[model samples]
Target: MKYQVGQRITGVINKITDLGIFVTLPKNKFGLIHHKDFGANWLHERQNYHSGQAIRVVVIHNYRGKISLSKMRVNDSQLIDQTNDFLETKKENFLSVLAETVSNSQTEIKKLEQELVIYAT
Candidate 1:
């Protein structure tokens, strides 16, 4: 149901295969998490993902009518502070980039406006 990349959703395990696990999402939507994405220890991880189990996953890809999901990003580590720092750094970097883009766009617009005034006169 109206899935987008990077969105976190909860679904039930519909089936599991050697390649990946299929989840039943809301409104009959479906998603798959490839074996490699299950982490470095996939075989062992299989025990944790079973049929009828409810799981939370992030939408990694939603293209060409298929939705790829992942549980890796939801995983936390013992180094909670490091994880928080990393996320904060990413968010700050994104905001900085956006701000720089807006500033540059404004400067360009002002130049264009000046050129238009010259042409009008």
Candidate 2:
């Protein structure tokens, strides 16, 4: 069967190597799930993946009869959540810095105003 990009497919793991895992798709086509496409949990225990193990992966690229699979999408929800949390923290940090800068500017302006008043007296 011809697989297109962004298609979700299930395949059996045929071989596992240090670089990637080869999965046998329908119609004798083989797909590769690169090490980088896997999550930290899977990366740490590479041996857990063995021949004949079934897995669901997303097709990332299909070109010249070669297909690439990505398990990253399986954890996409968690990644998005983490990203949002990080952005929120950064925004809070920026706001704090801005508030401090404004306070310091106000203090300097008050000192200048007192100096001007004394000079006028």
lDDT accuracy of residue 119 in candidate 2: 100
lDDT of 2 by residue, 16-102 (tens): 988889999878889999887765655676777889999887777889988998766744443232222234556659878778879
Highest TM-score scorer? 1
Each prediction's total of clashing residue pairs, residues at least 3 apart in sequence or on different chains, is 0, 0
Predicted structure with the largest lDDT when compared to the true one: 1
lDDT tens digits, residue span 1-121, model 1: 4676666678999999998999999989998989998667999998887899999887777898698988886553421322232345566498787788799999999999999999999
What RMSD does each model have against the real structure?
A: 13.3, 20.1
In model 1, which regions exceed 4 Å deviation?
A: 75-121
TM-score result, candidate 2: 0.56
Candidate 1 residue 41 Cα shift, in angstroms, is: 0.6
lDDT of 2: 0.77
